[model samples]
Target: MDLAIVILNWNGKSWLEKFLPNVIEHSDESVIYVIDNASTDDSISFIETNFPNVSIVQNKTNFGFAGGYNEGLKNIQHEFYCLLNSDVEVTENWITPVAILFKHDSNIAAIQPKILDYNKKTHFEFAGAGGGLIDNLGFPYCRGRVFENIEKDNGQYNDETEIFWASGCCFFVRSKDFWTQNGFDARFFAHQEEIDLCWRLKNSNKKIFYTGKSTVYHVGGGTLNKQSPQKTFLNIRNNFSMILKNSPISTLLWLLPFRLVLDAFAGIYFGYQNGISHFWAVIRAHFSFYKQIPETIKLRQKSQISKFYQEKWLVFKNFL
Candidate 1:
């Protein structure tokens, strides 16, 4: 098959049972594979019995999102690969636009479809609302989403356009480009790894894009709860590592410190709103980021674009 729709699973049997049939019905002619990340649940057995046509890739241990995909996808040879989340309900013709876009532009390394909330179909999803963008300070957001403020899907982002990053929830990428960058940085474990890969692709002059023609509804936080302090920790730590590896030294000098200051204030606010665990999560994220600095610096590419951000003061403008 030219395309492979690979779903990484970890004890998400109910999600597969609910959404996999929809994916099968809507996705035509594409080979589907469920990459099981050492799931202890009956997820693998259930897929085997219910969907005999779908392929299953079993990992020895749970490698988290980043490593799970990297490990599972090594053998699946296809021109294009869709790293789909198990919780997403796809629409018909979801693959056509993305495939056409990739064919027309060899430079287009990655693409994301219009993702709406599964619960609130009228509103864009939080993971990737109307495509992903980063600010001057390396804070990631989407066109239809800024911080926690999600915009209603009013056909405002219907045009296909270049994007800074493609959400991992429903990411499409040329197989060659994916392998060129060595898939994803497994060290990331989960959050912001897609952004890191897209940034690296951009640095290499490859393009990332979003298409409104195709749409999917994401049941966000299937594996990790959005409110979990562990999620916050991963988001914060991985984001810092991403910025450090991709940003030019000139920009990184000022941006890193500024983001650190902003994060301190954010931590306090998180504590006041969510709980003390979130505040401590931010602190722990910083410490983890510091420890990873040596390894992150070594992974930096030879060349990086100076102008990467889509906006300035995005967090302040959104929240303040």
Candidate 2:
């Protein structure tokens, strides 16, 4: 098969049972594979017995999202790969538009479909609404989502266009380009790794795109609850590492410190809204980022782009 639809699963038997059929029915032409991150539950057995057609790549231990996919995908060879989330419900003809887009341009390395919320259906999903974009300070947001504000689907983002990154929830990418970037930064473990990979791809002159023609509904926070302090920590820490690895040195000098100040304020807000745990998460994230700086700097490519953001001071523009 030219396309491999790979789902990374870690003790998500319920999600697989709920959404796998929809995926199989709509994606007939593509091969389906479940990369099990050493799930302890009966997930592997259930897939083996009920969905014998679906292939399974079992890892010895849970490597989280980034490393799990990186290890799992090394065995599955195809022209293209769709790194789908287990909780997403894909619609009919979802793969065709992305395939057509990829064929139209060899430089187009990645593409994301319109991701809607599974519960509301009318609103764009939080994970990746319309498409992903970054600010001057390397804060990632979607066209339909800015901070806590989510815009309802009004056909405003129903056109195909270039995007800064594709959602990892339903990411489509050329296999060659994926491997060329050496897959995702396993150091990320999870959260914002897709954006980091897309940034690296952009630095190498590859395009990231989005098509509203295809659609998928995501049940956000399937594995990690949105309120989890761990999620906050991963998001903040991974984002810092991503920016440091991809941003031009000249921009990093000022942008990094400015972001740190903004995050301090954000941490206080999160503490008031969520809990003291979130405030501590932001602190932990910064310390982790500091510790990872040597490793992150070593991973930097030969070139870094200056004009990577779609907007300047998006936080101020959105909230102020």
Candidate 3:
């Protein structure tokens, strides 16, 4: 097969029942598989009974996004793998443009389709706007999204472009490139793991991209709410681990400290606006990041590259 679409599921039967048909209908030419993360629900039986043609890989335990995909992908052998989310509803011919792009460029290691919000189809989704880009401070934003701000889709970002990272919601990457980076770092467990993989690829001189021709509507946060404290903790902690693992030593020296300062300010804002649970999530994230730093530095030393960041201090230009 030219490609395989793998959806990582953790008790998301409702999403599969709602959106899986769209994917199968849209991606008739590709092989589709559901990787179940030891769901306590009836997700496995539902897939087996309803979508019999679809293959299923049952994990012994829940591995989150990172480890679950890593475990599931070992069984899939294809030139390209689409790591799709169960909550995403794909449009017709969604795979054609990305397949063509991948066939044309060996250097382009990854790609993300134009992701619109399933609920608000006119607006870009928060998971991945037009495409993902990281500022010098290791903060990732997208052409259609900057933090919580999601732009309305008016064909402004319709052109295909090179990007720093592809959103995990509906990500595409060469199977070889994925294995080369050792797949998603299982240590990440969940949030920002895709960015960490993309960063490692970039450090090794590979490119990631976004193509507007292929579009998928994402019902963001199927597994965890955007405001969930656990989600906040994983995002915060994993982002720091990503920077430490992939950034050059010189950049790491100053950028890491600056990032912590920015994170502190974010904590203060959350404390005032949200509540103590959210505030404590940030504190826990920072403390968790600190605990992981020594190991992260070891990973960085092992994966050291001469250059990394594309735009230095992206906070000032993008945020300020």
What would the per-residue lDDT of candidate 2 be over residues 157-203, giving only the tens digit for each residue? 98999999999999999999999999999999999999999999998
Query: How well does candidate 3 score on lDDT at residue 108?
Result: 96
Prediction RMSDs, each to the true structure:
6.1, 5.8, 5.2
Give the lDDT of residue 99 in candidate 3: 80
TM-score of each: 0.94, 0.94, 0.93
Taken over the whole model, the C-alpha lDDT of each candidate is 0.93, 0.93, 0.90
**Candidate 2 structure, TM-score to reference:** 0.94
- Model 3: CA > 4 A from native: 301-320
Q: Could you give candidate 3's per-residue lDDT for residues 10-111 as a string of tens digits?
A: 989999999999899989779999999999999989988998999999888999999999999998989889999999999988888898888788899999
Which segments of candidate 2 are over 4 A away from where they belong? 305-320
Error of 2 at 307 (Å): 11
Colliding residue pairs in candidate 3 = none
Give the distance in Å from residue 149's predicted Cα in candidate 2 to where it truly belongs: 1.4
